[model samples]
Target: MKKLQVLYIAAFFAVCLVPFVGMAVTGQESSSENRTLAEFPQLKTEEGINVQWLNDAGEYFQDHFAFRNELVTANALINGKILGTSTASGVIQGTDGWLYYKDSLEDYLGENLLKDRSLYNISHILSLMQEYLAEKNVQFAFTVAPNKNSLYDENMPYYDSYKVSDNKNLINLQKYLKNENVSYVDLYEPLAKADEILYHKRDSHWNNKGAACASDFLLEGLGKEHESYTDETYTVKTDFTGDLDEMLYPLATTPEDEIYYDRQTTFAYVGEVGSNFDPRITTVNPVKTGSLVMYRDSFGNALLPFMADAYGNAYFSRGIPYQLTDVDTMVADTVVVERAERFLPEMAESAPVMPAPERTVSTGEDKADPEAVKDLEIITQGNYLKISGRIAEKYLDTESRIYVRTDGDKVYEAFPNDVTLDDGSTDCGGFTLYLPVGTATEKGNLEILTGNDESADIIFAKD
Candidate 1:
């Protein structure tokens, strides 16, 4: 009995030490996670064993813990079998091993309620883009990619633990867009109307066939000819682990058949580094009929080959701050802004521009004087104007009023929303405010009222 007890004690400590020991033997990065494994924490002279250090150490240890991947997979299995939920991550295991992302269900549930101003915001941007392109005699389209849950809501697990917002973001946005005279292609119906499976069983994005479907719709909608792809040329491989599957079970995952389109059917490009974001693609032998400048995301990856064949010169960029900054460089006949549905709010926010660390500071000494509010970027979102930047920490009182002076001394209040403390790289926090609807004019200036005695002007230009 004594020997048995001793052996049991030894086993427990061995099991406990195994992770630390194996961590030393393993590589510094995880193949499954596709990220660098945590390094041993360096001692900070100033921080010295504070909450920050301890928290960071805990994260680093957890990240580098040996056998962590195996343990996570095991936990996922146990949770799926027993709890009927994924506690390991936000991955949702659905009917017949169809995994879905938690964000999809959250968006469908309206957990992250897109504000009404967001509709006005996107429509305004699209209208501006359309008008700009029209001036250059360039056709433009804002193609909204359909959300996965929007189509396959039945596949999602039925459990409502979040506050659902009553905003029908898409319907409301579409109605507003039409009123604003912004041209766009709606892929939701066309994708749904198709008889064949358009989306992958395991991934958030659509499969090759779905891309083909969307591409076909876009070509027809834009008045371009559709290129044919025969099944004899394409190949299919089965049981591929997808993006959602990586979240749920990264190790030894199950498979689904992936269709690969023919690779031989596209044009090559001659390019210069126009943006630090993507090396701008210009075809070697330009086509006569059309040219394109496309701002796209991951779903656009599948559309690339199809688009390359159709356009003479095509420039594809995944850059944020979706602007006309690259217009003169590409000289395209068509301008396309393609966004995944969930990120519609991004249409309002301009891409952030920050100077180098040395240039970020003011030239004079004692530049950190307390001010009521420091304005950052300002742009119009139709009737509402959004002002974002930092506000003095002391003046961050919930009731502080920021307003705009429009139509010659007419005062309109700006309501702040989604303000976050310690958001930017500074002691002061950041805020976003939408000037109330119907307060806009052809040209006007905004201001912040700092108590009764003082006010600061906010200057902004759409260009």
Candidate 2:
């Protein structure tokens, strides 16, 4: 009789606890059935205390509360793929541990998820762009940001195997672009050699040092050059933990967040919309930052400042949409397109059909030696600039003249006789000409006239 009484009391307690368990899981007020706890459902008049119900129809409730929802199923599905496998990072263990592969799955992503040889067709796409832009006389340049894994793959426990001699995934794109006659900038080689910590020991994005190196490489490749420094004051914060460390190595590694190296004098955006330059939106205020858009990826955040000083303004933005809504109105004449190698194919495909660059417009006054003048070249370094080409000195002394302008400036300059004029095989005007590295214009129009004073107007940008 006593045992029967105990069982009856236990059954009573279990029945009483069911509602409490339901409340804990669904977080709904005992009376409410249409709202979810996360939605913070409350009686309209009450500010703090409110009913939390499980809404059967709302998206949020459907997502979190739905037992068979796709998202939950996806997580479980991914987990199940490696349910019994040991994690590459030994610390994480479980039949479900294989789901952790998401973090390091980029190596296999190309073949497994992304289309195969997508980059191969990128060259063809670029060629089409070149052909299309040629009609407009616009020159197209391609840049690709290298994957951090491409540089630090050695640290990874496993890598995807692809059949190609250039083990570095980024290098393959470079060869393809070259063969297609697409001018591309290489940041990987320089950044890899730089003596700075370019990335956090655990994070996927580059550290400030690495971004700066990449920016410098980009500037140099774009014909805008800058010097290197041992240390730059990037922002330093210790309270940062990266995604990888958050997941696999939770307590193992603590990472720091850093921005640019030194304090930069910010510049106001001259053409940006109302208060778009507000510092409240970004860590740094725009009015004081340098001039130049350091077009970059997550890795580009660190590198933009390195090149910002050279321009009147510098900005950093991602390339996904590749659309700067106001860029068409902000600045015109020159646009520097930068991207990592892995992203090049996509960048090239989506690249807008830019107008053809007007190399030699019909200036009306056309004079030339019966021979075509040797190729005139303008070399622009950050500090020094030079224009060199082979032209008939005799013609230059008389009918020939060198006309140079920058950014459409009317200021004309005389050709320096100091240039060595020697053409191995003179097809015309003069032989090859060598000019000092200091004579090129910074940002503006430049022209080199061979025989007649009339010149082919060319735009020159500083490196």
Candidate 3:
């Protein structure tokens, strides 16, 4: 009995020690979490002893331990196959093996819709961008890529118990854009009416086929003549790995079907090419004529090949606070802004980096109410002076246009945008304008003005 107990104890100790022994021999495993793994914890730092060493060590071990991927795969399999749920926080397992990105769930359920002001702000931002591009004779069009679940809700797990709103951010934003006369492409209806499945079952984004459809719509909207690719032949290859699949089962192989076009590509990379997610990528087509500058996000990955093929020179960027100056530099014939439906709020979160359009607002009676405008900030960014602040919500309406007056002489219209404060909080009443630094003196008194002639003086000192 004593020998049997000793053997059991030895087996338990060996099992517990295996990870440590294997880690020493094999080193840290590569992470599949779609994020940078925590580094090894250091006990000391330049400042002093590391106060968070214990917590950091725990995170490091959790990320680098031996058999981590295998164990994670096993756990995911049990949860997904047996319990019918996802183990990864960022992924949601749906019916028929469909996987949806969790970040898009709010849009799927019609929850957390953007406020009316935000919708107007989005439209105003696009309108300003359109006006700027139009000055350079560059046609501008904007479109939102429908969320995977928004179009494929039939495959999504039943959320009928949740309170779904009739008004969605995408639908409302489209209405505002239409009212503002901003060139906007309606991608949702066309994508929804398509007979074939355009999105990957296990991926958050649409497949190449969907991207082709969007590219056609965008090109048509811009009034640019380009290849429709309607009759292009493609082969369905079953070797595509999905990001969601990799996240859920790091050690498992589950390849999805990818439609690979058989046609030869006409465009070539302008320089050393990285992955699709690079901040900037340039391509050129020797046979094509016009130039294009497109500001896009992840959805642009699939659209890149098609857009590049259609233009003589195409510059695609995923940078935020979009550098609209590219249109001038590229002498672009067309500019397209593509954003995912789920990220609509982001449009109002930051003012795009562009010269504020000069405006002439009638001088209004200066109101002595100090509470009219709050939290004003003036900072220099690039060649422009960024002035942002929040106005009392009571003084503003959907049609109230925001304008900034410098030294009570020059007037510039501001985008009805929100500013992300230092504490990470955002206010819908925020307004931002970027005036050329030389055009506006930083030490001068500024004033906030509304379309209704409401005005309040601003006191600021430049550092």
Candidate 4:
């Protein structure tokens, strides 16, 4: 009987080993696949372009990350973790030597991805804004925010450093904009040179200390005077870790840390709010009670309010382009599009390609070819106006209709609903939308959509 029992136990153990062996093989294959580099001819530098091991590392570290603060019911799970901490403060050691408050996704990708398309799209959009502003006789200026990693590259592990210099998209973009005579504030070199501590050692974002420095520089660039807001006036928010710390090394043990912010302050900004799926304006006054519209992303949150106090209004947003159509509707005077360097390329690709240039409309009745309808041009009484252009082409077999939507009002208005420009004389199709003089102007949003999948937003304003 003892011998039989031993055999049964042995068989069970052997069965368990089968699954483990299969898992090991599968995991190894996945890792090997990850190490393989993606082929892209345009990229000038591919040295650290592929880090296949990052996903596996992220998965392993995710289990030990702690969440805290029940700021809202939606964040209850995190709140529970915060409540579990001793004195509402918890600490975790990191793969990076320094102690930090918590982890943040914004920090993770900001550090990991060097060339982002979002920034490129922002540049294109800025170009469009420049053209639009120029036609309106308004001046335009732009700034791109640097990430914590860019600010503290040397402090990070040697293997994790990003070579910002050789990044093709960023390099090309900066050159292109400079050549075009676009006015911009270069924060990366300044922060790197100033040896300023823009980000928290533990958290993924800049402290009020760092934000103050940036705000001062921005004011100087804008030809505005700097104001006084010292460290003494700021408060240290204790026991908080950001997204990167959560992702990189959660299980490692470390000491507690704090993040600083300007506690008592107010700001004013004007920008659109809410998603196109759900549109609304959201406002906040972190220091003093008041309202400010903010056009922002993660980078904007830290710096906006401080600058908001300097302006009569501030506008912020989370980088969802569909919602951007409402930009003019927010009654914003100055629009600041903030993004980390990595996101530029994607934004450029995603922008609506210049619609096929408008074709000349021929009045067949006259033996002469009619002149082409030029780009849409509008004049507003309040000194605020938006001019949009697109390339439109239509094929004969497939009846195509280009639609324009403003705010949530579908096809709020359009020039020509169904028009074909297939014939060679008119190139088969085209339309130029223009808001006539004395048109009712209000804060509104606009987007061009065809079917479910094809859509792009054109954020505009009218006085």
Candidate 5:
């Protein structure tokens, strides 16, 4: 009789907890993933309910499901531990609990490569950029930071199976850089020679030792030795997790050790950092030699101190969506472009990235701004309606705000891809936009929204 009573009470509690479980699962955000949870789709007056609404909502629930992180982690462990296979999360389980990112493998192996013309064009531009700086007594150099897989492929389980190809983008770029006499440094040999693991087993970036090695080469290239122990010190911390590992098993929090280093140099502040999009950094340091400007990616974060220590001042900026004018203005005695192997394709792109009307045109405004899109011409090619026009240059700094809608049908975003900047100042001279193909046809008209510059339905058919 007592056992029966206990079972009844257990059943009652189980039934009562369902609502609480539902509430917990409906969490607003996941700190582990480092991204916002998707919100419910908004109702649009112009375009009524669409098929994408249901798919988007389903995705939102899946991402925010109760114990999403725990379930992901458990699945990884099972697939990675017992099954001895690659996790669905794109992480490869290597020997001795080492995990490798498959994306890094793609990067290192030259998969999904860029074109040769683009690579050579990068070299040509660099040569021109070099001459532009050289006239001012500034030297230009390109630094190639080796990928983690390039240095530590042995740790991968199927490293022996992966083939090295000559048609690789990095290989071709390096060759072109050499042919063009582009001053550059490869950090592979020295970093690879080091006995210790210079890269984090769980992350894609280099560890302290690896960063230090790269710095050493930079100093060497600048015709100096890296013996600046005067004001530099380091502190170590353990139980650190890597970004890649966090993505695979957010709840697990894979642990590792990290070292933070500081450098003390003598100098005065010249100016503040640049805007968020274009991070122009200039600092005053003890070395009164000369100034330097480096177009670098994330790898530059670790190598900045070394550059700062060697030059009087240094300005670091992003390599992509770059402004040639900024490169000319940010004058330094030396200019170095530190590009990661994965980003080799960025070199082929044009300067200032002047996307038509520049990705920031007539967006979100209820009323059309007269100055938004100039010389607008809508034409059709294949299944696409192309938008060609001059966009006022002021909007180039942000994302393009243009929408396409078919009357009572569907809505899709337009991509303003091609551009030409006449003055290269604050005015966008030319741009080209492509409509989402399937929605536009020769028989139908499309409504265009350029931010606030809403337009009436216009026929894309040939006149």
Candidate 6:
């Protein structure tokens, strides 16, 4: 009996040592979490002994342990398949094997809607972008890809004490865009009315067929004549793996069906082509005539092939502060900005890097109080000068237009948007304008003007 007890103790110790032995023999496994694994921790650094060595070592072992992927897979299977829930925090398990991205939850429920000012800011920003492209003789259109659950909420599980709000950010933004006269494409209605399933059960984006539908709608909105895929031959391939699936079940083989068209490829990549997530991608189609510059997000992945086929020269970008200057450089005939509905708030977060529209404002009202404008700054940014500052909230309205008048009597209208301050906080009442560096010279005084005709002056110096 005592020998049996000793044998059991030995077996336990052997099991505990197996991971260490396997790690030493096979080395650390590559990460499947869509992020870099933690590096081996150092006991000392150039500064001195590493104070956080213990914590860093713990994270390293957690990421690099033997059989970690297999173990994670097994746990996910038990939780998702058995317990009917997701183990990954970024994924939300839905009914019928559907998985929704957790980041889209707030938009899905219509909670945390953007403020009226923010909606105005988004509309105004797009309006300014449209105006900029219009001046260059480039047509511009904007669209939002609806969230997965926004159109297919039937598969979503009901959360306790939460109900969908009628006033969603997307709805508000659409209203504001209409008021601002921006060309907006409504992708949600058609996608919602489609007969067949357009989105994958486990993916966050639309399928190829859905992308084709969106492409058709967007091209129509742009007033461009393009081929219609109403009867295009296609095959539903079953070897597609979704990103959400990867995040949720790293080791499990759960492939979904993806529609692939049989059309001959005509477009050619201009450079080393990575995946669709590359920051910049350019395509040229010898058979097509017009050029297009599309600022898009992940939804653009599926739309890339379709758009590339329609234009002679096409530039797709996933970068922010969108380089609208590309329209001029590429001699583009059309520009489109596509964003997901879940990311509407980002429209108000950063002002697009473009020259502010010159305007003639009548500075007839009384000067604004000195305390009304705060933290005003004029900094040189490349060939343009970035002027940004916050105004007293009480002086601003949803329709308020912020303008900057240089000492030379040149006035440029600012985009009504939020700007990130030096300390990493967003000034909600902030306005930003970009002017050509040649607009002013040496030392001068600048004036801030609002739609209400109130003005404030600031002394400035240029290096």
In model 3, the runs with Cα more than 4 Å from the true position are: 1-10, 159-163, 420-425, 452-463
Per-residue accuracy of model 3 over 294-409 as CA lDDT, tens digit each: 99999999989999999999999999989888888888889999999888889888788889888755655555356777888889988888888888877678767887777767
Worst 10 residues of 1 by lDDT: 354-363
lDDT, residue 231, candidate 2:
56
lDDT of 5 by residue, 324-399 (tens): 3454565566777887766665445443221122122222434435665566676765445665565454443333
Model 1 has how many clashing residue pairs? Answer: 4
Q: C-alpha displacement of 16 in model 5, angstroms?
A: 14
Give lDDT tens digits, candidate 1, residues 173-221: 8876897788889999988877777788877778877877788788778
* Cα lDDT of model 6 by residue, 1-463, tens digit: 9999999999999998887888999899665675678999889899999999999998998898888888888999999898888888888888888988888887766777778888889998999999888887889999999898878887786661165675678887888999989999999999999998799898999999999999999888888888977799999889888888988888895999999999886899999988877889999999889999999999999999998899999999999989777888889989999999888888898788899888765665655567778877878988887888787777677778887777747778888877567897666678887877888643576667677335423322222
- Ranked by TM-score, top first: 3, 6, 1, 5, 4, 2
Residue 408 of model 5: what lDDT? 28
RMSD of 6: 3.1
Candidate 5 vs candidate 6, TM-score winner: 6
Q: What is the TM-score of each candidate against the true structure?
A: 0.72, 0.47, 0.93, 0.48, 0.64, 0.90
Residue-wise lDDT of candidate 2 within 86-114, one digit each (tens)? 22231212231212223323432443222
Those runs of model 6 whose alpha carbons end farther than 4 Å from true positions after fitting are 1-22, 34-49, 364-377, 419-427, 441-443, 452-463
**Which of candidates 1 and 3 is the stronger one according to TM-score?**
3
**lDDT values of the candidates?**
0.62, 0.43, 0.84, 0.43, 0.60, 0.83
Ranking by lDDT: 3, 6, 1, 5, 2, 4
Among residues 3 or more apart in sequence or in different chains, the pairs in candidate 6 whose N, CA or C atoms overlap within 3 Å are none
Candidate 1 versus the native: TM-score? 0.72
301 Cα displacement, candidate 1 (Å): 1.8
For model 4, give the 10-residue run with minimal summed lDDT: 361-370
Clashes in predicted model 2? 59
Candidate achieving the largest TM-score: 3
